[model samples]
Target: MQTEKITSLQVAQRAGVSQSAVSRVFTPGASASAKTVAKVKKAATELGYRPNMMARAMITGKSRIIGLVVAYLDNQFYPLALERLSNALQAQGYHILVFTSSNAQDRIAEVISDLLDYQVDGIITASVGMTNDLTARCETAGIPVVMFNRGQDDAAVGSVTSANVAGGRKVAEFFVSCGHKRIAHIAGWAGSSTGRDRARGFAEGLAAAGMKPLAVIDGHYDRSIAAQVTRDLMARSDPPDAIFVGNDHMAFAVLDTLRHELGLRVPQDVAVIGYDDVPLAAWPAFSLSTVRQPLNRMVDATLDMLLAQIAQGEIAPRRIEFDGPLITRGTTLTPKGPKQ
Candidate 1:
């Protein structure tokens, strides 16, 4: 048996309304009166008619889709941020198409090409870099791009991120205030702006205190690498009394290594601090002292910048940075006053 598909024309006839009225009811961000909307919806339910977004996009030349590219979701901070971003975009009548890419230039180019092919209204990249060539391509295509939790050297590209440099400096200040002389840092990937800014700020802060890190190793934002770095650091004749890891994801691995493999007591033998106060940091097992990235605020800022670009079409790019707070927990000795 064959069944015919119901159309908006039929729905309008059944509801005793114009075909345009039925369209307004079905199209997101379109206007329609309450009576017309009620009638169209009722008629649509009865006839099992649904709007085809693809066809509408073809006619309107707007897909209402935002392509989101992320480097990796291994970090807890990213998953939470992505959820908030998705919800906020959906509320604004835009849907997200997520694509994951490696740090490689070729892979990122492929991802950008895919986004352009899809005719995405805009693009948001999380924890990924946009090369000048790729940026040129997107600009030529008239697709606005915003970087979330990442910054680019190109002033033309928009970015929203936590005050990573300030956050790193804060951690250093906290460690120094605690009287930790032999301090070391397990830095994030030096290739990233976030990592570079944080490391630079940490070094500057330590220098201001007339002290320097025992060792600064690039963890590359990997758990296993961080764990190995922890071992290598501890094996030194004069090991670090305190270590500040670039992120909570790697910090967890550092904590595990200190406790399980090295049989070291946290804050007793070695105190550890990390950036990005993810949910797991608060757990009793870790109780990690960390700098909290203002995830919600950052997400909101990203949405605002992205939507503005989409609306204004090639407006000046924005660089937004929000300060993060330092949270002290069991992993570090609490200082007198409020948490740093």
Candidate 2:
């Protein structure tokens, strides 16, 4: 037997209210009196009536869905950020539709096209790059795009990221303060702005102190690669006394390699520092010294930029960056008192 769908008209009749009143009750941001809301909800529950979001979207031309595209979630930082983004959007009566994309340009374009087909109100790209053509298509479709935890040269798109450069500099300063002469870096993927910025800042800081890195190698944001890089660095005639890794994900691998494979003592033979103070970094096993990316504030800023565009219709793009504090832990030597 086929069951027919219950319409809002039936609910309105049962609640002794107009169809529009029933609509206003169900629609987000729609105004309805308390009495009307109670009656409509009671009738809806009794009749098993639910508002059709698709029909509402067709009428209002707003799907109330935000498309979130991320390149990878293997990194602990991204999963945490994604959860926060989803929760914040849900609280605003908006739903998130997640999509994964490869770093390849074609793959990213294909993903954006699918998002456009869904008529998503806005798109947030995390750890992914957007091409100019895709950006133009989104602009033509009147869909706003925001970059989360990634940056691009496109001025048309808004972006929110931690002050990666400053974070990297802090790591260098801490290492120099500890009197480590030979310092090296296992950098993040050079293809990413976050990676490049951090490397640049670290170099600048070292240069300011009249010291240069012993070696700077691109880890490509891969654990295996970072492990191999650690081996290669250790094989050098004079190994670095301190190493700064791009992010905590790779840093964890470095720590494992140093301790288990190379029999090195942290902060004794070699000191390690990383970016993104992920939860695992705090564990006694790792106790990694790192720069903390303000995830909550970054998420808040991303939502603010995205919502403003959705409401205002094509406002000026904004680039927001937050500075993170360097957290010292077991992996790095603690300053005796204060720097001279």
Candidate 3:
């Protein structure tokens, strides 16, 4: 059996308002008085008149949808950030279309091309890189793209990230103040800007303090790999007294391997610090000392940048970096001043 669908005109007739008023009541960011809005909504409720987003989009040239691309969700920080971003977008009367992309450039290009076909208002990519050709296509289509927790050399793209360099330096300062001479760092994926920046800063900070890392092993942001590296670092003839891991996700593995497998005591035998103070870091079992990336602030900043582009014509791309504070816990020796 076939059924007829209700139209906006019928609701307008029932509410004793014009079709234009009915349209305003249904459209987001459109203006209608309270009485008219109430009457139109009441009529719509009685008639079960649902707005067709596809038709509306055709008329207004706006889908009110932003495409979000993410490479990895393994880290707790990313999941939390995604939730915050979704909520913030919803509050602004916008919707999200999520696409998962792998680290592979070809897969990322395909996902982005699909997003463009859907006519998304904007895009936000987390931990994914875009090629110059893809960037040119997006520019030609007049779609603004913002990278979150990632960086690109292209000036046409925008990004928001914590000051990884400063965060790394802070960790080095803490280790030096705590009198740890033999320090090493289990680095994140060397390909990532966040990873490279953090490693460079840590090394420079150590050098400035008249200290050099005993070893710097690339963990590639993998738990099993980081654990294996930690074991290898321990087996060295002159083992490190302290280690700074790139992120909390891998730090847990490093901590577990050092304590359980190697039978080493934290702080007493080997101190550990990590980046991204995820909730797991606070668990009684770990009590990890780490640098805290301000997720809420980062999310807010990302949205602001995205919306500004959506409002104004695409302007010069800008990069915003927020400051992250080091949170000291049981894993590292306490410094003289109060932890930030």
The prediction achieving the highest lDDT against the true structure is 2
Worst 10 residues of 1 by lDDT: 331-340
lDDT of each: 0.92, 0.94, 0.92
Q: TM-scores of all models?
A: 0.96, 0.97, 0.95
**Order of quality (TM-score):** 2, 1, 3
lDDT of candidate 3 at residue 235, scale 0 to 100: 94
lDDT per residue for candidate 3 within 94-183, as digits (tens), equals 999999898788999999999998989899999888888988988999899999999889989999999999989999988999989899
lDDT per residue for candidate 1 within 1-340, as digits (tens), equals 8788899999999999999998889788899999999989999999988888888889998899999999999999889888999999999999999999989999999999999999999999999999999999999999999999889899879999889999889988998888789999999999999998999889889999999888899999999999999999999999999999999999999999999999999998899999999999999999999999988889888888888888888589989999989999999975546677
Candidate 1 at 16: error in angstroms? 2.1
Identify the superior model by lDDT, candidate 1 or candidate 3: 1
Off by over 4 Å in 3: 336-340
Q: In candidate 2, residue 46 scores what lDDT?
A: 96
For candidate 1, give the lDDT of residue 277.
Answer: 91
Model 1 pairs in collision: none
Question: Model 3: which residue pairs collide?
Answer: none
